[model samples]
Target chain A: MSHPSPRRTRDPARKQAAILAAARAVFAERGYENATIREIARRAGVTHGLVVLHFSTKEQLFVAATTPDPESLFKGVLDDDVTKLPERIAASFVHRMEASDGADPVIALIRSAAGDQQAAKALLQTLQQTAVDGYARVLDIPDLATRVNMMGAHLIGVAFSRYVLADGPVAAMSPDELIARLTTTIRTILFD
Target chain B: MSHPSPRRTRDPARKQAAILAAARAVFAERGYENATIREIARRAGVTHGLVVLHFSTKEQLFVAATTPDPESLFKGVLDDDVTKLPERIAASFVHRMEASDGADPVIALIRSAAGDQQAAKALLQTLQQTAVDGYARVLDIPDLATRVNMMGAHLIGVAFSRYVLADGPVAAMSPDELIARLTTTIRTILFD
Candidate 1:
């Protein structure tokens, strides 16, 4: 086979990045049932076939585009100092959610899940597998699962109120205030 | 003018009740945007004009169907015993949420809000006007607004996790257990 040029190799990667970005926008805007592959491909400036080639199905594409790598996400927050975990976790969550470059995937999942029971189940599964389980392993505490569940529930609530609902005092809070408040509440859930 | 028959007076009340019930079912099943006035009328076995005559608009009908009388709701929970407020509030919320007769109106609001920003705003406004403000006035604590926001956020999160997402340890929790757990959390938020 002829040697591939550098441009040829770079084209696939560039095309994929474009497609993923477009997918996130479409999914966030229209949710699951309303979102279409044609729209995503058109927005990405790629052929629909290329999108299908890269990700065989819409579900696969949605999962790939919306899911932050769990390993990296957990590693960043799951530091050795148990005393500081609450602050680190709360700050990290607030920062990721407030990131302006891309839509927050968890919020997108929640919006979509609101109308779709299947999506809601998938979101819960994703959170359990990624957040709750990760926390359980890291935190040395009794009833770890229940504690993690409460912690996850509170964070999810703050997210729904602050990001999804986007109103009320919770939504009006400055990021630092939100982080500080959440850290205190999270610590209570974990330790108190 | 001739006195109207008793049946004529009762007909309007009965028709209004039917329409409200049907509206609730349709809104819960199809969400806010997807629900149709015609469908609600059909389910109620009435003409579309009747639904409009009673409520004037789908928005009004939605508010009628999903909103419990806030006065009655608050009266039940906002008792004089400040020490028991956490338990009373938590238990009241869990009971109303677990009511099997009609759909939980708050959950309906939340689900509908997920797909619609305007609906989300309305939810926040309703909660702020009803739950947060009511709690603030009764709790008699410093920074009551912020504390109520935190309490509301945690409760909303629990609702989403248990009622909406419907999985995990939170979902599996018995009503008594949930109420107990929530009372502790709410008390901490309110007092500690």
Candidate 2:
């Protein structure tokens, strides 16, 4: 029998990356409960068994898709000077939403969580503990958890209304205007 | 022909009010699409046919249930002095949420809208025009529409996170504290 081609045994790392990218897109579009492993595998150009082998379960795949690298999401905002943190964080969130063509993964996660109790719990934990709690410590303000939570809720609300709901006036505002408006609000919550 | 009893000929207005109340509860619990006409009728102690006679269709019933008297929702917030508008609005929203035991009609509307495109469009129109735009006109500030929309989004986010998702820190925050923090954020958005 002829030996299998080397191309057929391509890099495992590249294959895994492709699967993850496909999972994010699929989950973002159809949500966690509605998105199936088969569809994700098809989108990734891999077999269903391969997806199962990698992610093990739909929940695991969902967690992978929605919980992107926290560093990537927060980036320089976390390490910046304390006083200017609000502006930097606001700018970073707005820039991230713009870069993604206004379909932030966090919004998708929130939307998906609306229908499922377990999903909602997962989202709350991810956001409250992993995201907001960490930022609260870095800021080192009294009652910072409440402040961080409120700020996050406001930012998420803006994203949902402006991007997902596509409210006319909100969607019409320029990026500079949005960043400025958001920075003001964030400053009030974080510093004031 | 024998005359019918006066009790059998119940007051149409009273019956209509009962039906609407039941519709609100059912729709709030089960959402617009998931709630059935029969269940609403059962809750109202009326026949399904009577519900149809009053509301015409499921869509109409949903509209009636969610679109409570605007004055009831906003109360005195719209007419308050511009300087105290933020605190008044924030207090009113938080108070309404507490009054409803966290199952506010607006939150129900938002949850229903998450799964249906038509429902989402209807909600956006109701919120943007009937609520935010009206508040914007009252405020008379430049870009007040954006401000009102952002405020609405933030309040909605807080309600969802605190009441719907029941986030620990958000849920634990007292109404006074919640209103206070929200007032500061609203002030930043509206005035700063």
Candidate 3:
């Protein structure tokens, strides 16, 4: 005489989200090498077998953890050409990155991909396409691909070194300083 | 002839150099994650036990491996005033890096220390001392400690993302482009 259980149907979605969250956390803490399927399952409060049953392996889980926001990352930057090209591109990159000050989950995914060639290629291709396509569509310039790529490198590289690596001088900079200085530098690179 | 055989003592130095070279190559190719003592020994054309006898452990070997020209790293950069700081720092840093590009053999040693917290600390401390001691002696700057640390983070983070992680756009830029853009961007941060 029991009512139908709400937990049974909703459990899958909840479990999936939990698993993904666990994957990101574990990957960040352990990087790619030390992260294990059992640890992820434990973090998610699921059984080890359940993780295997769902994703098959650590690599699969790593890939899945990154699946949700692919299109959004592209769309966020691409469609945000609300200002003209150089300013929008430079500002948006720093702004969005600065937004992730306390919560840069994408960094772990990106950094871990470096250890695996195939994963790196996938991430790299998507990044290049989104940046190149967005810049080309939004602006009229010579060497669109090269200039965009170079400017993009300095922006992200500077940020990564300063914020993520907490590399000294850069980490000391306030976010406003970061955005202003970075934008000014990259603005010239992109336009002038 | 009863020879004064300096060659008698020379072989050990030769062996040490060979081991260092092998360790560097192995560390760079596999990074900290995949590198192993066995593989390094194989590369050195020495037995595993020989490596142990010489180095005691991988950790000791790593410390020994980080010996580069620390004195030269900031020598040229701090020679001038604040206005010239950015480009000077960039040139000297990149010059040191570029000069050692192929001849630099301690990469595996550095990579090995990346994740292990104690090891990361040791490596970081060495670099920090190098930057501060050198920069403070040469430059007319205040807040040398903070600047040294931040610069370390910036350089390390940038190097990891650009070279080791090969993060898309960061990976694509040439050395000249990297130095140029990084130099300009680091200007505001490096100066008042």
Candidate 4:
């Protein structure tokens, strides 16, 4: 086989990050339906073969791009005691949004996955497996399953509508205002 | 040209709705990126020329498909006083989800619209404009623009995540449960 390209062979870590970043941009711009491995490779300044060799598939690349880094969206909270449930849960949700830097590319990914079943199976499960569990640990309700799910739905729906749809004044509000209002709602539901 | 299609020449209302339904399905399935008038016509069981005769263009057909007819999402609310705010707002959101019956095609439309300027502008603005005006009128807040926009973002975000993503248990909850939990949260911010 031909030797790996010299530029790529020199810096594997940088190449990996470049591929991930490129995947995010292309996925955001084109949505999963239209985004292609070739486009991502082109955006990353890498060859088609490199993408396949690195990520192995477009689905895998997208999963890597969006599957929220569990540590990033919910790291410290998991270790905290149960009594701090409401604040921790609220902080976790807020952290995810803040970590995203308001770009909310994950929203684009979830929306794309909505149109594609396999993609949906991957992207839509993050909350069920991650967020719900995090909240469950804190709430410790016997019916934790239902309550966490409800609150999760509300938070997810509200965030998507306000930020992604840019519906009315929500999209225009300062992030601080949003945090205040949403944190109140979230705190009430989780703590009360 | 050949004789006009019977639906076009004799039954404008039937033909118009048929085209709109077809457009909605096409936008929902193929999304804006790949949707074409030709495909919409084929789905509608009409000739391409017939689609043009009614909608003039796919963009027009798309707007016509999502455009609120009786008013916008908020028309009914604006007609009444502020007391009906909670139920009306909840109903507005629930109605859209119920009408779509959980298979939200609008998600695909919003996702595909990220790159299409005209489609994005029309769809996003319609979502924001009507709800802002309606929701703002009901609440006590004097600065409607900032508060409404922020709340709108939360609404769309939560709805998309819940309804479109079908985020497992979250989406499975009954409308009554959702309204119970979310309505209180909404009231806290809007009424208080």
Give all candidate RMSDs, comma-separated. 4.4, 4.5, 5.6, 5.0
TM-score of each: 0.88, 0.85, 0.69, 0.78
- Docking quality (DockQ) of candidate 3: 0.26
| TM-score between candidate 4 and the true structure | 0.78
Cα lDDT, model 1, residue A125: 69
Q: What digit string (tens of lDDT, one per residue) describes model 3 on residues A28-105?
A: 566666678889888888888988988987777776774435445545455545344444455665566676542334
What is the C-alpha lDDT profile of model 1 across A102-180, one tens digit per residue? 2667666666655656755765667666776688767878778887888888987888778777777888889999898
**Residue-wise lDDT of candidate 2 within B88-169, one digit each (tens)?**
8889988888888534666775566445546655665676677665686577777777777777778767876777777767
Return the lDDT, model 2, position A28.
64
Residues B119-187, candidate 4: write the lDDT tens digits: 755765665565566665555567665655445554555555565555666567787776666666556
Error of 3 at B133 (Å): 2.5
When 2 and 4 are scored with DockQ, the better candidate is 2
DockQ of each candidate, alpha-carbon based? 0.61, 0.52, 0.26, 0.40
Instruction: Provide the interface RMSD of candidate 4 in angstroms, 1 decimal place.
Output: 3.5
Global local distance difference test of model 4 = 0.63
Find the 10 residues in a row with the least total lDDT in model 2 chain A.
Answer: A1-10
Each model's lDDT: 0.77, 0.73, 0.59, 0.63
Worst 10 residues of 1 chain A by lDDT: A1-10
Chain B, candidate 1: TM-score: 0.84
lDDT of 3 by residue, B93-152 (tens): 666666665334223323443255344345555667776787776555676676556455
Give the clashing residue pairs of candidate 2, or none.
Answer: none
